[model samples]
Target: MSPQQKALLLPKKQGNFEIGSRSIPSPGAGALLVKIHSAALNPVDYKIKDLGFFVTDYPAVLGSDIAGIVEEVGEGVDNFRKGDRILAHGKFSNDFAAFQQYTLTDARFTAKASYEKIPSSESFDSAATVPLGLDTALVGLHGNHFGAGLTPPWTKSVGESKKPIVVIGGSSSVGLYAIQLARLSGFYPIITTASPSNEELVRKYGATHFFDRNLSGKEVKAAISKITDSAIGIVYDAISLPETQSVAWELLANDGTLVLTLPASVKEDEGKGRKVISTFAGPHDPQNEELCSSSWAVVEKWLSEGTIQPNKYEVLPNGLEGIIGGLERMKLGQVSGTKLVAHPQETQ
Candidate 1:
């Protein structure tokens, strides 16, 4: 029998998660076998259990944000070796998922971790908060088909864009990354809305102007007009709630694209020429593979230089068992401005 590892498994479609044992998978060509240290929870994890939309197989593991140490490297992978600390965005498949002590990771989606180095600001828990949220923001802002079709900062040769961009729910995990990416893309007057308590937090992430989330659509639009005359060409609605979507639509200029992490709540009108693109992020998807690969290639440097900041995280106790309550909190809208992380190896 293969080596056994503790995993949080959803036994069936729309089923409850339970602690279970699964075989540690081996890395195939161009992959790495990772011993997961921290797995961060996202809204999609609970949504998958409730809606059963993303996974077709039963008895599945669901998590996308993974940070761990490489146990073994597969053939053709020369950059990573055994014992290297790394972080990678996981997939829906059981063997590649993050809710287990051990899983396989594609080399292309993995990045080096400085978790062990002195003076390093990153750790497994913090790095685990980055993958899914950052990828969603990247695809929403730069993906031609999945997003606004803006030029990526990594490849663009132009100077500061000086254009205005708005991020709804700026305190959200995806919202945080959207703000950072907006700054990197040279979008000035980065406007965002969040709770008063999170205004400082959002500003630290590069939101040049902040508004109260309670502001009505017209209120925000009127306030934004005073900040910049530049047309609001991109409104990344990381929240995607009906109220937030309405505000985003109000602030968007004609011909502008609204990027949403969830399905658009507002209908696009033919007469307005406005476009709404819902982002589907994950390197496993062929549509996102190329763009994700480019961003993943620079992840290590970005983390090292603090070009990208991980979200604030609270590590849940009880390892795998703690994830259940974390998901419940997320589903109940009890968790805010923070990512919940669990250490799978601590399961007992």
Candidate 2:
């Protein structure tokens, strides 16, 4: 029998998550076998168990933010070797997901998905918070199909944008990355809305202006009008709840794109040329493959240079088992301004 690893499993559609055993998988061509150290929880993880979307296989594992050590490098891969610490976004497939002690990753996404070394400055918990949030923001801001179609900062000299961009829920994981990427793209007065308590946190991520997230849509809009007259061309709503979506729609200008992490609750008006793009951020998706590959190539530099900072995270107790209560807290809106991380290797 193959070596076994502990996993958090959802035995059926809408089933409860339980600790179970799964065989540690081997790396295939252009892939690496990872011994997962830390896995970060996302709202989607709990949503999957409740709504039963984005996954079809039964008795499956679910998680997307992965940080670990490479255990084996597969045929045709040379950039990574055993014992290298790395972080990569997980896929929905059982063998590639993050809720297990071991998972497989594509070494680099030239024409595939990617994995890269964690910067020495970061801990596994901090690095685990980055993958899904950063990818969601990147695809929403730069992907032609799912994003606003802005030129990526890594590409040849398209000068910085002088315009302003709004990010609702700026303290949220995706929102924080949006603020940073908007700064990198040269969007001035990078306006964001979050709890007043998180103003400093969002600003540290490059939000030039901040507003209380509790404000009414019109009130926030009126406040923003004073900051920049430049038409708000992109509104990345990381929260994507009904109320937040309404505020994002209210602030978006004509011909602007509203980027959502969830399905759009507000309809787009065709006559105004405004668009509502719900981003599916997993790099494994064909639509996002190329754009994400380009970004992944630079992630190591981004982290090391502090060009993109990882989210603040709190490590949960009890390793993998603690993720259950963390998800419950997330569902109750109890977790705020921080990612919850679990140490899978610490599982009993």
Candidate 3:
């Protein structure tokens, strides 16, 4: 490997992260060592840090989203040799994560990448914003019985059934991508809730109609009903709120599916037949890496062709040492409308 390297280090307990020197991670058999150019912080990033969601070790290097170049390939690691540009969701275990000068990656999740041919003036930050959102959005759409140009709920044939899919928070990182995805699935009205400022933007992403539902589940249900001209077929909540499931239940069509990043509390409501699909989705191991790798290529090709634009981002200065401050900005909710990305090498 490359000897010692600096990494944004998260302490074992809940606390702020620091940049520390550590031995460069060597890619074991079936892994590739990535030289990270930038990493994106998810809400789960902080929740995992401060609240300690799913942790297996302390002083874990906490970045799960990364975009960079492959500096070295481990034995048996093909597909992505050294010098390939790639992006990946951090392998669940910190040992296989991003946020350092180097990250250990699953070879399957990495893919050959070049930003779609644009004006050739775009920066890495712009090109770096789509992977995580795109992957999760795609997964949620499918899990909730929706797919690109296909009726939701995998079935036998066209005579099988039809359903309405509702996408709440259609302007979030996942929500924005969900808008376009639901449209591709041919979901009618593609109901979304966003601030007035984002209504037009969400509509462009393919929301058939828009509504300004701030928090009232009543308003949210009413809006979706009006847009669909009936009950919602399926519901997908990108926002990780505990009560979103309840809101979804109120508008669901009979036997409709509900998908969430968090567990929706549908069982306690006594609706035994309703389906509660928990999207416990994140970076899966070997089985999912290949799927993610291919989906990324599709999303990237769309971006390159201007079929989609990367989500907005806030580029923080100061690199490694600056991560603490950036994390705080995200904690305070100041970093909305964009993802926060940092380049540790630039700070180095």
Candidate 4:
């Protein structure tokens, strides 16, 4: 029998999460077996339980942000070796999810920053906050089908554009990365909306202009106009609430694209060139595969060079058990401007 590992499991659709045990899976060809050190929480984890979306199997393990040490390397993979610290974007599959002490990761999505490249100040908890948020932001902005189809910054000779872009929910995980990536794309006067208290945090993530999230659509538009008169050609609504969606739509210029993290709530104007794209951040998705693979290739360099920064995070207590309460806080909208991380290896 394979060694068993602790996992946070949802036994059924819309069911409660509990500490359970599952066999640690092995690395397959082109995969790595990771001993998870930190697992970060996302709103989608609870949404999966509450709405019964995504997973079809019972007793499912759900988590997407993973940071850990490579325990074993499978055939055909040479970039990583045992004992290397790495981070990966996990999928919903049981073997690949982040809620377990050990999980399998596809080599294409795994990243390890060399000690010389990454600042010594980086931690497993910090790295765990990145994968999902960075991928979502990358795919939404550059993916031809899953995103706005903008030219990726990775390609050579791609000059920066001076166009302005707005990110609603700027303090949220995905929104924060979107703001930074927008900055990298050379979008000037990057504007975003978040709680007034998080203004400094969002700005640190590269937002050039900040507005209170409570501002009405008209108010936000007026505030943004004072900074840049450039038409807002791209709006990444990371929150994707109906209210935020409405505001994003209202602020978007004709022919602009609004990228949403949730399903579109606002109806598109017929004959208007505006496009609403609801992004699915999974790298495993065929439409997103190429774009995400390319981005993952450079994630290590981006982190090391300070071109990308991880979200601020708070570590949850009590290992796998603590994730339950963390999810509740997220559902209640109590968490702001930080990711919640769990140490699965500490599970009793």
How many pairs collide in each candidate, listed in order?
0, 0, 9, 0
Compared with the true structure, what per-residue lDDT tens digits does model 2 show for residues 244-270? Answer: 999999999989999999999999896
Judge candidate 4 against the unseen true structure and give its global Cα lDDT, from 0 to 1: 0.92
Tens digit of per-residue lDDT, candidate 1, span 1-348? 998999999999999999999899988899999999999999999999999999999899999999999999999999999998889999999999999999999999999878433233348888899999999999999997788888888997657778899999999999999999999998898999999999999999999999999999999989988889889988999999888999999999998999999898899979989999999998878888899999999999998888898999999999999999999999999988899999998999
The list of candidate 2 runs beyond 4 A from truth reads 109-122, 157-160
Residues 1-348 of candidate 3 have per-residue lDDT tens digits of 548878887777687777787778788987888887877777777777788778768778877677778888898976677777777666556556767777887765554446656333334556556666766777666632322223332222233123466777777778887776665555666777777888877877777676674657787776566555666666777775766666767767666666676765666335645566665445463434444555654655566566666677787788866667877887886765577788868766
What lDDT would candidate 3 get against the real structure? 0.67
What shift in Å separates residue 138 of candidate 3 from its native position after superposition?
Answer: 2.5
**For candidate 4, what is the TM-score?**
0.97
For each of the candidates, the C-alpha root-mean-square deviation to the true structure, in angstroms, is 1.4, 2.6, 3.8, 1.4
Select the stronger candidate by lDDT from 1 and 2.
Answer: 1
Regions of candidate 3 where Cα sits further than 4 Å from its true position: 118-123, 144-163, 266-272, 285-297
Backbone clash pairs in model 1 (N, Cα, C under 3 Å; residues 3+ apart or in different chains), count: 0
Clashing pairs in 4: none
